[model samples]
Target chain A: MLPLIHRFIDQAADQNPHHPAFIFQERSLSYGDLVLQANRLANVLIDLGVRPLDRVGIYLTKSMEIPVAIYGILKAGAAYVPIDPSAPLDRVDYMIRDCGITHLVSSPVRKRALHQLLERDTGLKAIVGVDRELLETDPLTCLSWEEVLQADSEDPPVKVTDQDLAYIMYTSGSTGHPKGMMHTHASGASYAHYSAMTYGVGPADRLGNHSHLHFDMSTFEFLTGPSRGATTIIIPNEAMLFPTRLADLVQNEKLTFWYSVPLALIQMLALEDIGNRDWSSLRWILFGGEPFPPKYLRLLMDMLPGARFSNVYGPAEVNQCTYFHVTRESVQGDQPVPLGRVWEGAESRILNGEGQPVRPGEPGELLIRSSTMMQGYWGKPDLTEKSIHIEEPLPGFTKRFYRTGDLVSIDEKGLLAFHGRKDRQVKIRGYRIELDELENIASAFDEVQEAAVVVAEQAGGDKELVAVLLLKEGRNLDSAEARKRFADHLSAYAVPKRIYFPATLPRTSSGKIDRRQLAQEYAETA
Target chain B: MEITKMPDKSQIESEIQTHFQGEGIELERDEDLFSSGQVDSMALMQAVAHLEATYGLKIPPGDLVPENFRTVEVMADYVIQRR
Candidate 1:
């Protein structure tokens, strides 16, 4: 068993030193060059006092250097915490402080952002800018990217076991705080090994990676691509936003495997005229993160007749447990695509409120047991216990299951159909959002006495977040200003589409905010 | 079918509104549909499909830039040019 994911790249480098490992922005890095750069960075990390299981932050935009930084952290026996460079400085500061991160790897353009974060007393010790430019007037301790690359091209001697942590990915928590999901090397490796096999990835395949590094799905490109000795093409951020450009990239890069949120596919299909383009090189198209609009899925199928589509379903906590391959028979009916069966080495159970297994054709909360399951939420034992449960031995086995909080029904054919979420968690354009987090951020505003956020369904069946705010007596609030304030703390997707200043908020019998009532009223009026 | 003349701005706006089923309000000719949240990615796709079918215009991938679809006036101009 591989103790760390970097070893896979090491083996690949040894086998095919001249093969292209990463293709980004029209530049290619061979396996040998990648490994040597990673090794040099690892030595630099060791010299910078990164120890076993220590958390290092990677706060850079999408580029070839991202893989180098991730593998370097892994080789140094430290888990990499990926922070979106575009995220608000306050949010970045919170993550750095929350995870006790002392060292950060970033690009030169983000030096000012790092300085702003350091001004908040985040205790960030050192910065490793991935560019050669030196900040002469910077107050924080910083190292140039060239200095790290100049270090010895020898792997650092770090004792990392399978049980050691690999990464800590942060997601929105129900209580408005960001929670880190901890994954050990074993868990990550399990996901990488299984997903690669499932996709039939090989050295000849060029995988398309469009997801940001902060997202969990990017792990497929970061870990699985190297493990399978395949090439990864990092889709530029601009291409990700513009679907037509992304489609052009698919043809230009000759990507064999593509994985991203369904929204990207839908956008590409909508914005791009691929009817005349030659997409013969494309083979597999896998999508998840949110439900794909069935109508658009059919259109996408029509566009890419040669590609095989798979609807993958899994939360960040459980990696990927179930997948349904899109077939003519599956897409023929009025029903949306069913989330197929569990992948190898993973088991799923649907249980009712009483923890009793739901019979076939019944709906219940989905629970997952898998080797790829996250270790736990970092530093939150209460939340960890609430999410994961350990059951007593049944016959000869003790089972540990993670509650998915998603309501699903397994049909008589053993195909799982997603019903809806069982909680306030919602997905907006592929990002998992907790409504409570948005409400908490809204209420934090000085002019707002209370806040409630609800998802409103439009005529087209797309859900939009609407925020209802109650102002304090004698306080004035501007909606645009409030939105700008909210943008400072939350992601742009989490910002409410419409803001309403209600005279008084509706309440439930127990005096809690009545979200359902608010949603209904808003829908009726707006 | 050949279109003898470019559609009026109001005609284009009404068609867009009908396509979106009146989800937005107080639409301006130059208002940005995306930034104003009048249309999301899904709605944008639906609008594009609707335009292609209704007007018999094939929008090439390169013309899908935001400048061409940012406003009703720009979209109408794009449709006229394509026609």
Candidate 2:
């Protein structure tokens, strides 16, 4: 049988039964306990009428239960779909209805949101890890964590191959609705294998999980960390909001591996007093999703001299494909490090808009044909077709490449140099934001007649979103209401920081909202 | 908004209420405001500025932990403890 994704954790449990599998708030779940809990939960899911290949939603904040839910779903031969616990109810409902997720594994921490979600007409058959009281309101099944912990620990009977679906991660699309990127066991296993081998993580390694459960960055900590018998330390969401607290977590956890977005490190550098901290245990640091600004990258390197750093690169469509290790000699002053070469098990091609190969050093879209590539966007075949390019190099043999949408070039050092996105999708705080999605959200509001969003370069060199709205006559929205509205639809980091009410927005000759002109105006004002 | 002393718990609570009032955010006292998108970084910093301005206490960034700033009651408690 091909190596299944959850088999990694199962094998680890067999080898290192007493080793810490996951850690939170100083509490450790041994591999033995983790396996049992996952088995029990898998049995509970199976009892809840979950069939093989069914999608289970994980609506949770960062917690130890996340790993349990993930492993349990995979053990039951089901695809786990992680939904952002903080997402708007409509968006959450959209994912559930769109993907036909019948069972959701969530913690009590999401009780408030889950209650609100229950009020919506979601066709969920069961919500695991919730209070029994919810049954009074919703007739569907609600199993408490106590039951999952106490249920039968015998492994459930299942037959799953690597080709079976494993998970679907949803991200904002340029279109109004969010899109789920589907990954099978084969893809997830490939990613875990490549990242674990690339970083050389092992049984003794302690991994700091800095990303949210829904974000693709968590793949490493969730899969690779346990696959290698490393103990994963989940960083609480509360700590993430406070940079000093996050620095405290890194020190207290003594995590050997730290993988997160560059924004996290930059915030710590800006807000924390690193001189007095004991973050000496960290040996490897990987940052991805967005470019790591050189000035802050240099500062982080100087501070964490004992740790090796890598600028991890790739889109969620294809799991992390490249890593640029940082050394004093590799990165010059304010010169960004190259994206490095693609790792084993993955190949890439740089093609221009005309779908032809670009010159060696010319910039073009990065297309990746990797074992880690997602199957496609869930329920959106047209979108999947649009996002990927296929070639028939050999008769009766076809090759598929996911278009990264990231513009890159081969630098003088023969490494990939990343330019910005090929489209209006700009990243803020490592979260992808399709500018048009923000506009669509604003336009949907009753007050907004038209809206436009622009990424403004702030004085400190950070990017801030500035939104201009042409409101309906006599209707107005202040920053607070706009914030609530936008935050209700998008992630916290994706909310536009600045709002402007113009009597009328600029327009092009074709009567389109001239975002270019608005962007220019904001740039001038900044 | 100048005061000679740290405000009482009620006063601190009222100030926090006023800060988030314009944003139309209503939450349980102990609910997680930060992660739920109810409180953005800009809003959090503004609340920090509001508390500092009203109570005349410089909140060191380290004190911005959830215990002190996640909810109105905790924020009030933190401010009340400052005296």
The TM-scores, one per candidate, come to 0.86, 0.93
Position A407, candidate 2: lDDT: 90
Model 2: per-residue Cα lDDT at residue B30:
63
The sequence of per-residue lDDT tens digits that candidate 2 reaches over residues A47-157 is 889888999998877777888999999999899999976566778889999999989998776776777777888888798998788555656888999988889998899
In model 2, residue pairs whose N, Cα or C atoms come closer than 3 Å (at least 3 residues apart or on different chains), thus clashing, are none
Interface RMSD, Å, model 2: 3.8
Off by over 4 Å in 1: A130-139, A394-397, A524-526, B1-83
Q: Which regions of candidate 2 deviate over 4 angstroms?
A: A509-511, A523-526, B1-8, B11-26, B32-58, B79-83
Across the candidates, what are chain A's individual TM-scores? 0.96, 0.96
